[model samples]
Target chain A: MEKKIYKPTDIDIERLSALARISLSDTEKESFSCDIATMATYVSSLLSDVSAEHEREARSLDELREDTPVECDCARDILALSPSLKEDHVAVPLVVGKDKEGDA
Target chain B: MNELIFRSLDEHKRALTAREYSSEELTRAYLERIEEKEPSINSFVSLCQDRAIDAAKESDERRRNGAPLSALDGIPYAAKDNIAVAGLPLRCGSRILEGYISPFDATVISRLKSSGCVLLGKTNLDEFAMGTDTETSANGRTKNPLDENRVTGGSSGGSAAAVAAYEAPFTLGSDTGGSVRQPAAFCGIVGLRPTYSALSRYGLVGFSPSLDTIGILSRSASECADIMNATVGADSRDATSRPFPASDLRALIGKDVRGMRIGVVREAIGEGLSEEVLEAMQVATDTLRSLGAKMTEISLPHLHAAYAVYYAFSSAEAASNLSRFDGVRYGYRAESCGSIEELYERSRAEGFGDEVKRRVLFGNFALSGENREKIYGRAVAMRKQIIAELSSVLSRCDLLLLPTASTHAYRAGVKKSALYCKDDLLCTLAALAGLPALSLPYHRDGKLPVGIQLMGPAFSEDRLFSVAHLLESALDRRESAK
Candidate 1:
């Protein structure tokens, strides 16, 4: 199997760096750019000898579970463990909820 | 407390049933043990003190009323952090959900609760069950009880360490690849990855859903079989839950191996195997042969790709499964974001562990439109080929022989092997096939024990257990002779 190196774009960097929440200097970004590319190359071997039909479903098994059995206990527990909890939930400083779609 | 922690779950259950130890006493014993040992061993992430004591007190009440539910009643068992316990932080050994607790119990947890089992605590694991070594946990690394400086074998390393250290009689671990079996081998305990759908995945934070199965680690395979007997079967909550028939997990316990067909995969005994491991495997094969079992040599060239396929498929799926933790709905949220994308980037970057980020970034790259065909698709095809080849091999024989690992216990403090160490290693290949594999510990050799793995066709857990039990007994006899 032939291997191709996929370098992380600036947008990819912006996306992941923000997601990871770590301040990466330009030097770190430069290194990470190389590291991420190498890592992608390493995982790219998964591309070899794998069947296309098998992955028709990207995540493989389509395990869509019902959103029922609203668990109040787990939330209470997490809230309880939170360095700080309020209004019956673990309250972080603030969060901007993303639109449900396109995230996947 | 340490002594109590070391006893098997069956022993604890017997004591509880006989009133030799009150539920409160047993719970207290484990709690104390955790306090003393966990600091050094680093086994648990969360210990639900009030909840565990309350459950123990309730079990005490039931015992007092002469109405205890089952043998497992009042016994304490730890869950791998990846598996949720209602109201406990399912940190998954990662910072992403450091304080995030699910609102419901994992299906296995729920079943265990209904059976009257006490939650000892939650054990440490690889960050999101990604690595084979537990060093990447956000909290801290879980040390192997047997060898403190060495890895405890991960994803399920914490659970295995707990069982090995006697922190808990039995513990729950998720096996995606060799998470359960590898640790079991490292810790010298019995670990069983039951048939693919035998256990429900309702509450297990998915690593690789298709290959992930909730495995049980215990002092003996029998203990694991009992737990499996209790937990296996369909669950309404998990769509993939298979219809497992209710029968004694060890029903074929005494099935003589007089005429059973067993084939040892010649390809499995390649270079990466250690001398000790080779000798141990030879003993197991010899014992089965001596017992009148017809053993044969088989080939599985496709297995060479199990690691490749496993990494590709599992990592790709992981990138998707973890997308839900993006700071918005639940979990850790990093503040001071200008845009939604910033919120996601910062939240994830801050919340997830380095290993998780590595998986996600790598997984994303693999599944991206351009590389999807080149990598993820090809790995899937390889997996399909491997599975089909395994099925064909199964057709030739009833069971396949496996040397749990290609090496013996790598002693603590050793820098990574600077050699060809991939082949015949890790529990991923059998796992990728979603087949039932059992790792049974042979006798201890100067405190380091070895194990042989047995892999059976899909849904052949019953058959696998039967063979395993026989081997265990025979191995026990061999140990006594020594």
Candidate 2:
């Protein structure tokens, strides 16, 4: 099997930052690209060296928690902390169309 | 009052009980010290003067009524900024959560409060508890109390520094990788990362859920034990917490380790270790031997990969956990954003420091598509292997002894890449295994301090305390003789 190698590019940084929803400046992009590439290379080596003989079964979910309803004592307080709120509802920007569709 | 600020928690308790000093006086002394030293150390992000004094007054009333709480009653301590304290700002040393107040106290805080322990305030940490040096904190960098030009090792640097500088008798520091233990070493104090789930993490801001642990930093092993006794228990709020047999940890201290089998991790001392750290390890081993504790060299062959594994898992978890700060419900919200996406991007971009952004980006990459199997999956497997290896080795020994860090605390702003991972290399092994580890100040090279670390199997905190107490006394005697 061919050993995987990672060399992060500017495109990779842009894609990842988009996924993480974090904007980055050009300087941050260049620097983080290098750091990510270095770390990826290191993790690749660790993956390749992992012994396959010690593979164990996944944990059983027998202890899965039951669905139980509990009241949150600070529910009102939590909502009050929102950046924008309307009638006790946490108000967010419309996800679908732009301003025209939502307002109309 | 000046001397009162430097005394141990137990001593403060004794003095408080004897009416030699009031809890109000003790609290005021610490507050004054914090006021004086905080400018130089930058340890506290917030000072709870009004709250602390009120709590101290209440504690004095309780003491007067002959109803003292736990051993730590009337004693003041600080919490890392990540731990939630009711009505206090939970900035987490980041600009994102600035001015965000916690509505409720964390389970540990409530436990401490119920025991009459007064809160001094929240100390600084690496932003989101992501970095080893507290330098990454968005609030500001914490300077080592011992040397102003040097860094107080982080992400609990401020907490460790507060205790070391006598601003607080002890403090709570959360350990994900080496957050607590590393800073404790750097600040010349004692820090313990208890077994994962030994202490409740219900109120701690999440970093890496699997590895994040609430730990204690103090002037002595006994004090750490005392605090642990008060805080350690099962909590319904945190499902990961489990019930353990109740034991008095303070009673375990001062007991001799006559037949304790200590394992010296051979790989920990090889290459990358400094001469002073190596000498300190040697003296630690000899001191343990002199105290009649047996020592044997043990190896964890896969230990070298600890940093890689730790970063992979912790970064991935951090990415998921921090996504909650999306400029929506709470935290910093960017103004003049055209869309929700822009809101998130702008807020996080402005809020997170470089180190945090770097890790978050790496996390996203690690968990995406094929990289999930190649990176995250394999790292998980490696973690299991490492845990198994540690468990096997620990089966033969009572504890594993090693240096907490490869070298003494470095000067502030030493931007060498090699120094970044060095803090976690020696300490991550125990963290990965979910075992308890303690870093105790061992040797001081001129002004800087070196700490020796000990790792014990799960729930072996009592035994670790006993061994550490004996070793601390032995080292003290040797120092006094010189």
Candidate 3:
């Protein structure tokens, strides 16, 4: 028995949007549903028949660049350019705790 | 209009050597023209007036002191905004990176600087270079220089327009599936997507890492070679960059095209190609044949699937590469959010344009766990097939000729979704194979130019530009004779 090819119309835009971490408005959601469906249909129609699988050859040890630390002169400048910095490091929102607003 | 702005790099060098005009005068003339034409064209995203003048002054001093840097010394050129020029805005034509400025120059920018090329300003592009037309830009659309109503095909439209409008002699652009070549074709200029890794991608903002190549747009193939000669080399910063010694790219210029083996892509010339474009290709073929070149018909089996393969791989890479913009370290951040996840979602949703969001979502879909093997995996295998097919054909022929685009420049408001496949059909093969390709314009009198592409094997830029130079010369002679 042969397997059924996935249909482009079956794409769950809400799920993909969640995975991509993009919050789409109602109108955008409607728009993307159609756009993604069209693109997927186009791609699926072309690629469904292809089954060839090939991988690039692994590089020899000598071909790889030696793993060594390189000097970086713009660390201070990079840090300064950050929008939110705490002391010497970039500040991020607490991952597993009350929000900054709650703490305040 | 100042004729100085229209001179080729070589002509400028010669005139400067003869003391015809100082670099300052040339730079100012370009700046003046840019100021006058910018209101209607809207090609530039930002200008570097003071710094450009300062660089010009320094270049003049170097020449006066008999210590000139390189052949490009004092030449004014614009770069696509995505390429970082230290202290300049690095917006990538997206609202997400609105206030961001690059802290350091990209490797190419530093290399061009060392060669004493004056930076005019940064040009507009598609948001994150994700779209075909410049209409997707957060900055205003870049109108075609020849016709304001029509678009300068993007995502390197601004760079092409700058050259077409004589705002600059030449400019730098990035091609990841025909961004550079398509725009150059529309604007009737020369565009080169050099062999992958021929030039370092250290400072270039990544769109699709594997396919993204820093391309050159100039008035002529010889000028493209001049710019490439100064910029092509390996950089430690870009691990994919190779130690290419293919310097003196213009060495074969003016060489006889006699007995040169050229293959015309059979599939590319058939249905879906515009009639005028086909006519232009016919004329180009006759011109090359008249010059004693051997032209034959060739076919690539996988050419039909190139667009699908390109969208899958490029979108996946784009999704991963863009994951760095999480509203944390750099770029725009959301105003208020409950958690980090919400912050990420809101910032990305509010910051990115519609086309970008669609691609990002589609990319995530392709790379998602259940669909990876079915979509992204298949694209990988298909890409290898394309590479194999192209490599095989290139082995037989010295060069492959095809249309750079299906049609000439179209109106600005034409949506991206409608022309999706047709727009990218001709340009994706070179990007997929990581081969060098050049787009040279050929057109009838007072008509929109049609670009004919020349593709060659990897690291074959020297030959590619040489043949392009030959064809360009033939066309120029024919044009002048008219």
**Whose DockQ is greatest here?**
2
Which sequence of candidate numbers ranks them by lDDT, best first? Answer: 2, 3, 1
Please report, in order, the local distance difference test score of every candidate based on alpha carbons: 0.76, 0.85, 0.85
- Fnat score for model 3: 0.55
Tens digit of lDDT per residue, candidate 3, span B1-482? Answer: 68788677789989887778989999999999999999999899999999999999999999999888987899999999999988999999888898999877989999999999999999999999877778889997999998899989989999999999999999999999999999999998999999999999988997799999999999889889899988998999999999776658876566777998899998888788898788778877888888888999988877888999999888888888887777875689998799989999999988888878878888998888756766776777778777877888888899898999998898878766422644586899999989899999875667888788999988888778878887875554346436
Selected candidate, larger DockQ, 1 vs 3? 3
Q: List where candidate 3 sits over 4 angstroms from the true fold.
A: A1-9, A51-104, B418-421, B476-482
CAPRI tier for the interface of model 3 = acceptable
Model 1 misplacement above 4 A: A1-104, B409-426, B473-482
Candidate 2's DockQ: 0.32
Model 2: what TM-score?
0.91
Off by over 4 Å in 2: A55-104, B416-419, B445-447, B476-482
Ranking by DockQ: 2, 3, 1
Residue range A10-97, candidate 2, lDDT tens digits:
2388889898899999898988888888888877786577776543321221247889988999999676544575696656554324
Best by lDDT: 2
Instruction: Put down candidate 1 lDDT per residue, B401-423, tens digits, no spaces.
Output: 88887665565434221112244
> Please, what are the lDDT tens digits per residue for candidate 2 over residues B104-143?
7999999999899999999998888887778888888999
